[model samples]
Target: MLPRFLERLRQQADNLAGLLGNRVALFGIELQEESERLLGHLALLLGAAICTLFCLLSAVVAGLVLAARYGVLLEVCATLAVLFLLLALGLAWYLRRRLADAPEPFEATRQEFERDRLALNGARETAQ
Candidate 1:
């Protein structure tokens, strides 16, 4: 009887360990997914920034060449430069606002943690 009881206890310990391992694996998977998503967004933003920079540079060069060919180069270039500067500032401000409005990442994980805490507190209260 003692040996059988010891075997059963060992079996239960192994099962508990397995359960914990599975939970850890699942948590790791969730973290990986979130990290991948963040990286993807970062990559896209970087690509967009590179493209916009190229476009802005092209536009400025084109504007300056046209102004030099058709009008007073210095005055036209100054005006174009100021216009582009203002446009860049406006876009930066808009991006700031948009970023502020963006949702928090890993919100689901936070909510799940809160729910678990509440449930544990409720269980503790019931026990008391």
Candidate 2:
């Protein structure tokens, strides 16, 4: 009877180990998924930014050419350039603030880990 009991206990331990391993693997997969999503979003944003920059440059050039016909090309171009720079700076600052305010990544995984720790502790105490 004691031998059978020991065998059952060992089997339970193995099952617990496997469960823990699976949970860790799940956490890793979730982390990877979130990282890939963030990277994809960054890439898309970069592409859009490049396209917007090209458009802005073309518009500025066209505006300058039109102003030349009106005899104030230099002044108009300078003012437009300064305005665009200030706008870009303002947007960059705002984006920085928004990113800083964003929640920590992998929050779900963190919560799951905490719950698992508490559960394991409770189990251990009960067993003792």
Candidate 3:
């Protein structure tokens, strides 16, 4: 009877391990897909922003030249626009770096919880 019970327990342990393994694989796939989507979005937005910035900068330079020729005062505006855009880009880069440093969601925590629970149960069984 004890041998049969031990065999059944081993089977259950194997099943539990299989379930956790599947969960981990699924979570990894989900994480990979999310990361890819976020990176793709960032890439596209960065590309569009860079293109728009180049166009705006060209326009500003042209305007500055035209203003100088016509004796107007838009050099200050052009300078301010460039400065503000650079400041915004710097802030965005800083934010992206900070977000990248954040930990993955609940993965380590889940593993720890599983370990703790298994240990507690084993202890309880031994005590009994």
Q: For every model shown, what is its TM-score relative to the native structure?
A: 0.61, 0.72, 0.59
Better of 1 and 2 by TM-score: 2
Candidate 2: residue 84 Cα off by (Å):
1.9
User: How do the residues 1-128 of candidate 2 rate in per-residue lDDT, one tens digit apiece?
Assistant: 99999998999899789877877887888889778867876886697689868988898988988898899988888888888898688768866776687667777677877887898899889989
Off by over 4 Å in 2: 1-9, 86-103
| Selected candidate, larger lDDT, 1 vs 3 | 1
**Positional deviation of residue 40's Cα in model 2 after best superposition, in angstroms:** 2.8
Cα lDDT for residue 83, candidate 3: 76
Q: Candidate 1 lDDT (Cα, whole model)?
A: 0.75
**Per-model root-mean-square deviation over C-alphas:** 4.5, 3.0, 4.8
RMSD of 3: 4.8
Extract clashing residue pairs from model 1. none
TM-score of 2: 0.72
Model 2: lowest-lDDT 10 consecutive positions:
94-103
**lDDT score, residue 80, model 3?**
60
Residue runs of model 1 more than 4 Å from their true location after superposition: 1-30
